[model samples]
Target chain A: MNSELPFLVELIVSAFILTGAGFAVIGALGLARMPDFYMRVHLPTAGTTLGVGCTLIASVIYFSFSLQTLSLHEFLISMFLFITAPVSSHMMAKVALHTGVRYVSHTQGRPWPSRTQRPSRDNSQILTEWPKRP
Target chain B: MLRIAVIIAMLMFTVSVLLNLYRMVRGPDLADRILTLDSLYVNAIAMIILLGIFLGSTLFFEAAMLIAMMGFVGTVAVCKYLLRGNIIE
Candidate 1:
């Protein structure tokens, strides 16, 4: 049998490895350099979703090519990451909001998840006496 | 050899773990520290996977999955605590 197939396969595998490594480095750089918590929260979402996703796919591709069969476990793990990282980031953001971390300096008075809990302009008569609840 | 590649990855992971530790230590706020810890989990999982491939076993993959699951739970728990000052509330 000619050896053309193995070289082509190895080249493809090496390409995947390089792509994964690049994504990982970008995620780390985001972690190191984001200006604040909210932005930082946005940063790792990219890492966990795209970076880890790419890395795991590369793992599966490399192993399957080398072993001449599908190595599917990496695909499963990547799916798990896709499900978990967003939930984690959302939870952290909620925590930050509840802890009064202030996503914006000017909008501190608005209650989260709803603006209906506070009085409308029609009901502003009541808050004028209670010091505005802000 | 794959073993050498795995070793190098492990060394890189060790460095990443330490760098995240530095962020955890000096993070200006709790959220930053938590973020760093979460990144540590991702790195740890990758390192464990590489180690498994190097050693010709699938067992470490089990540990890696467990770590990923547990790390998610831990991060949620910490966020809950920060949000409500209690997990149950």
Candidate 2:
């Protein structure tokens, strides 16, 4: 068909789409398979960032070449996803910590304050940032 | 060539969504379920974008953008609710 895309363009677009979908699938698999909440939290970043990034690029190429006009608007969604994914993951991880979700026993180093040293509700006693041990 | 590729991509995305669903349903904790939900929405976005490419429609872009915004807000609100009993507080 005369209207079809050239072979090289088709190949490139296909490659991009496949790569994106592959990353997304792996990310989802990681989410399902990770042993702990923290590990699960780290998994979906692959999907939200590189996965979406590659797919959006493919869409840009398809629409731009097929329509014979530039279509940069898709970047808006990609950028939004990039910004939001980390922030959401961070929030989720923080909540996980606050809730005392189980962690791997062999995890190295202490990050958050130990559960026994709960911070007081009094505003005057609370530090601006990291809590200090009494 | 492109058509076949789009089909395969769609299948892969569907599998990912199903995996997310499995995690959401089998969660050992509330936070784990919510995190799966987060991944679910992102996977959904990928699916919609793939569909748009297959159908050659620009209309899907708006839907994808809206989903991204709403999904982020929903996740943040839920996480806040988990951290603090009240979302507004």
Candidate 3:
């Protein structure tokens, strides 16, 4: 029933936190240094997903050990982040394309479809219709 | 040992946030700015969670959760406006 954490637990938590911070820094570096918006957009996934994941795991372990109860709630944040990060990134990329953000000169890909075909719909029309308020 | 780790991690995260802020301000394009804003919030949440661990307080979790939700909503709304030129139409 001792409240003090053992050495192993502290080490594990420290490892998680350090790893999380490292990933976050790497992600931010990519965002700042990348040559194009599309490349920059892909970088923060490192922070939003794995960076948060490691820190949350650290938090959960630290709390559960301190409180002597199985504290699993930090997972909720990571879960929500996991669900939202990709979607938010996708939306940002779409906006970038819709607004005609320029790619780096050497970026290899087919030219984006002209905005005339449809603004909301991509070539595949993944989201053909806007959601209506019920 | 843990204290040192927390200090180092927090320093790194602060630098990360600053990098995101630089991109947001220096953006040559609107979408690039928006993307940087989105990444900024996410990095902020990581910083908050790290703070929680450093301070040994669970209260910050609620703040982190709220940031996550609001950040997603804000990104979506802005992206929507950029895409369609109107949020509600």
lDDT of 2 by residue, B58-89 (tens): 99999999999999999999998877767996
TM-score, candidate 1, first chain:
0.68
What tens digits encode model 1's per-residue C-alpha lDDT throughout A1-134?
A: 11333666545544554454455556766777666677777766776456556556656765666557888887667777779988998887776665545344544255365232234424567656776455
- In candidate 3, which residue pairs get closer than 3 Å at backbone N, Cα or C atoms, i.e. clash? none
DockQ of each: 0.36, 0.68, 0.66
Residue B73 in model 1: lDDT:
89
User: lDDT per residue, candidate 3, B1-89, as tens digits?
Assistant: 78788899999988988988898888889988888888888888888887887778889989999999999999999988888768888
Candidate 3 residue A48 C-alpha distance from true site, Å: 3.8
Report the TM-score of chain B alone for all candidates: 0.90, 0.96, 0.94
Q: Give all TM-scores, in the order shown.
A: 0.74, 0.88, 0.88
Candidate 1: residue A28 lDDT (0-100): 68
Top lDDT prediction, candidate number:
2
Query: Which candidate model has the greater lDDT, 1 or 2?
Result: 2
- DockQ sort, best first: 2, 3, 1
Which consecutive 10 residues in model 2 chain B have the weakest lDDT in total? B80-89
* Per-candidate RMSD, Å: 7.2, 4.5, 5.7
Off by over 4 Å in 1: A1-5, A102-134, B1-15
